[model samples]
Target: MTTETSVDVTRIPRITHDEATAITAVENRKFGEQLRSLGPDDWIASTDCERWDVRAMAAHVVGGAAGQISPREFVRQVRTGRPIVREIGAKHWWDGMNEVQVRERSDVSTDELIAEWDTNSEKARIARNKLPKPIGRLPLLNLPEPVGRQPLTYLFDMGFTRDVWAHRMDIAAATGHPMDLDATHDGRIIADIVAEWAGYFDEPFTLELTGPAGGTFTSGSGGETVRIDALEFMMILAERTEGTGLLQHTLPL
Candidate 1:
């Protein structure tokens, strides 16, 4: 995580490398456990990602284990600001990890899914730990300017936490299973995402979140803005959805 030495972070607490590592481990295990849950026939069913299914999501989880970051030589080429991955086509880049999954695990037994999870979890933990501390978040610099500098690292940290829960819903929705969240992952993500809505929206809008569990919502400081319990809201931020909704509920300053 990046540190702004000058900023007083009383409101936005930063998560450490170790914390990131642990969360990655948690996500990996959760994905495996969920995948292991399926009957053989369920692999081809639809998933939240639109074009993919349970199997494809499994492929993505495993592919995440592959060299997720660009190599040193490539990163060097991207020095000064341009992202190395940005130079490549989305399909081509995704293919790199796809290659890893197919090459390394083509023969992986269903029973070994959790073991693969453990392997990738450790690999991701070590790799993230070895990297330099973040200069800024936004793991990928996709947006155009100002907001591009948004706290993506926090988004990523929050994403993983949210992913485990959301994807559990994804899995559950696909397979008709029950949903339950561990307190650790649930609270952190809910907090960060709530704050993220406050930070992202231009208006001093207040949110009214309504989900299956209950109904109570978060409002920004000075009654800025509000976020409803729209799964679409979470999916859009997760990049699982293409566009945004109700971004500005009120007039801005």
Candidate 2:
């Protein structure tokens, strides 16, 4: 695997607006399909997310989509959720927002949840893609260390899609749902992740990631070499599993 041609991390281009929009739409549809296929048992299954079952995970996805449908909706969620998060002793406002999301939809039936996801995900795609360039370039918030601050475009283009993709993996693990990975779509996302990971750590290493979405990536030379499954690597980066050494550094999902 190491013998495969190495991709220069610096050369990997940022995902363009069109690519981001397309990927987000595809991911949303796939997630909705996965939700629709869940059975009663699957809905209640425990996932890698410590506090969430499959149902709660789905609710979070729906809530995230709803918030992204409009700037007004997004602000409303932040305003309503930040105080609640502080009350709950959570460090991040998003934790409160996620909690509120799950609580609001706790009583929603499985079918209704699926329906809402379908509607809101579509609306989110439209709203995000329609964001004016000037607004998108503005910094959204100041995040913690490693991720000091991010622009609105980061959320629209990468953050939200990565969040849903990571959670989709979570749902699949809990329910044994077959993931529909392909070289084209999933591969693109994985490659982008590799680029970010390599750039963030900025050390010498060779990564041999196996599976349809996998590839060989290298940065500098003579660094630690790691071989792992592509999806599992992503799971680690998303902090769903413990990692060691270089892998311990993570990118926000």
Give all TM-scores, in the order shown: 0.62, 0.94
Best by TM-score: 2
For lDDT, the strongest prediction is 2
Query: lDDT tens digits, residues 160-218, model 1?
Result: 34444566667766776654445365434444454544555554433444444222343
lDDT of 2 at 127: 86
Error of 2 at 1 (Å): 14
Off by over 4 Å in 1: 1-16, 68-109, 134-140, 143-166, 210-217, 220-233, 239-253
Report the error of model 2 at residue 68, Å: 1.0
Superposition error at 64 for model 1 (Å) = 0.7
- Model 2: runs farther than 4 Å from truth? 1-4
Q: Backbone clashes in each candidate structure, one number apiece?
A: 10, 0
Q: Write the per-residue lDDT of candidate 2 for residues 117-147, one digit (tens) a residue.
A: 9888988988888889999899976776567
